[model samples]
Target: MIRRTTAAKGLALAAVLSLGLAACSSDGGEAGGGETTDTNGNEETSAEPLTIGTILPVTGTLAFLGPPEIAGVGLAVEHINEAGGVLGNEVSVEWGDSGDTTDYSVANSTATDLINKGVSAVIGAASSGVSLAVVDTFAEAGVMQISPANTATDLSGYGPFFARTAPPDTVQGAALGSLILDGGHCRVGFLVQNEAYGTGLRDNVQQAVEAGGCEVVYGGTGGGQEFAPGETNFGAQVTDLLAQEPDAISIIAFEETVAIVNELVAQGWDFNGTTYFCDGNLSNYGDDFDPGTLEGVQGTLPGAQADEAFREELNTWYTENEGGELADYSYAAESYDATILAALAAVRGGATDGQTIADNIRAVSGSEGGTEVSTFEEGVAALEAGEEIRYVGQSGIGPLNEDNDPSSAFIGIYTYGADNTYTYERQIEGSI
Candidate 1:
């Protein structure tokens, strides 16, 4: 669910949301320990020590999302180790900071470092831009990589070794369009950033809305900014929206949705009794945007209260291990899944080496060996059985399609309740 805010006049924010949102290849035989012999005629163990690499933006703009993602990785690691390190050998992680920069040289250097250190696979670069920059390097090295939260459609076709937890923005946008129509909105406008993420999301929404029998009246565009964080000076865009007089205006931008909402309210622009927001603007964005301002907005996401059990568990874990707050972000869960998925792939491949693990990543995400498994434990068991394992994770239940893209369930629909609090509305009907 998302919050609704008033816009000034022009409702022109349907382009910026796509900005932030990977790759690799290898084919040779699997490397590392093959087989071993033991006394007493016991079967030899193929257990070999392995290390995995992780790159997260622990500082700068996206730092807030890093901690939870890292925590998820840690939890997955603990679970894997407790069950006996993959293949009977200890597994370890090597972490690096992406440092949040436009030039991904830092991220690329970090990936090279991990490759040199001999990690079996890599698990991050939370931001899609960073992931794209370093993906080729990892691919060249034959190291498999899986990002927890990148939704851009372009990345899916980048390489064989790439996979992600977030469904592409095209699917998400389409889902949101259907949501807007089902919610009784006839005319939908959009506010977006002028980046890949935003354009991608806007395109999806446009297509979905058209398919859903809704009309697109206005679409706004803006450049990404760090200062606003969830607020935007969308006066120009709001003015345009007012002119279009759309029934609902979907802000497909980031960090500016709230500002657009608040400005509209201040200007006395009613939603004209329509709702606003898309997945890009679904976050709470902290205290910067008043909760009361979003009393009636809505959005489509990959999770929702339907998974209340997991939500409660996540909250409990944060309270116990963190400072009592789940970092205000959604990507954390996906990041954790990536780490776990990579680890499981390493185990199935039977070697910690990059080529071997990269070749076998499909075992965890593909259909041949992966079926009827949705939890981390289930994936591990399937791997142990020497059968291809289908790992349907906490993120969703869909299997990874041939493009290395997992079909995702749009289960998160939210609404703003009284007192600036948020509540889960209802889950969406199907997978994207």
Candidate 2:
């Protein structure tokens, strides 16, 4: 495989020195120990260690999602190691934080640190906009990047080494649009976050709604009804959105959703039963709002609901390792699936490099016909027996498409209760 490297700007001098020291300490083999055949048919030995890193949100607007995502990665690592590790060596992980778009420096620095640490692949940046900021860096360094929750439609086919476990907004948007129309809402409005994720989903939802014979009364793409990412005060935007007299309104944002809801209540708008939320803001609002403040509100989140067994496993692993109770299982399944897929790809390709993982990820995901397996141990065993194995992980996603997006996925519908918490109503499957 061809190797690529570029100078990472803005990194601290200590980090560069650390990289140099690590290089000096190398045992003269590939970062992960593996044997490669030369052009002359001679076998050469190299180190084969698969180091995975993470750029998940630990702080910022999306921090609420951090616990489950982090737990998912940790659980997957534990499983892979228990399955005798990857490439004959224990798999190691380096964790870093990917703050929201409000601060690109956090993700930028984290990406640099992970790359410098010689990670073969990264799982990361739940926010699509945050992923967009650092994807090029990972690509330039030949590191595979797989996001568990980035759903922006344009991110499909964005990079040869970039992939996501989450279905794009096309699936979630259609499901949400249908939900609104089915609720007898004829005039829909959107208060979007004015970013790749928000706008892309808004457009897809609008298309679905219009096709269903419902009119978008406000906040259509390019209508200038969007707000900045970190904008806290929503009085004017809420006033304008309410002025349109929309019966159904979707607030597509992150932490700012709390402020927007408060503004809506202050303006005498009945938020109950009329508000909608997307994955970016479908979190439990019990701590932020009064009881019954969000009663009857509905929202949509991508991915199939995790079953009880998997949830228990994740919670058990998290409490033991991270010392916390798992509050939500939003993208935990997706994150675990992403890690498992990468490990299976490494086993199939006989190496743990990013290019090898990228080349084999689709095949491991069942893009082509193979023996179906569901766990890391099963997949590794099948591959070792000279069988092509398809790894169907906890996330029940179909094979990877030509663009590296899931061919089909399930979108979960949820409704808020009187305590400002949401309960899963049902799941709708959509094919890209």
- Who wins the lDDT comparison? 2
State model 1's lDDT: 0.62
lDDT of each: 0.62, 0.84
Tens digits of per-residue lDDT, candidate 1, 238-298, equal 7767788787877765545657767777766654236656554566654655545666667
RMSD of candidate 2 to true structure, Å: 6.4
Best by TM-score: 2
TM-score of candidate 2 on Cα atoms, chains taken together: 0.90
Q: Which residue window of length 10 is worst by lDDT in model 2? A: 20-29
Cα lDDT of model 2 by residue, 361-393, tens digit = 998899976899999999887777777777788
RMSD (CA, Å), candidate 1 to true, equals 9.3
User: What's each prediction's TM-score?
Assistant: 0.78, 0.90
lDDT score for candidate 2 against the true structure: 0.84
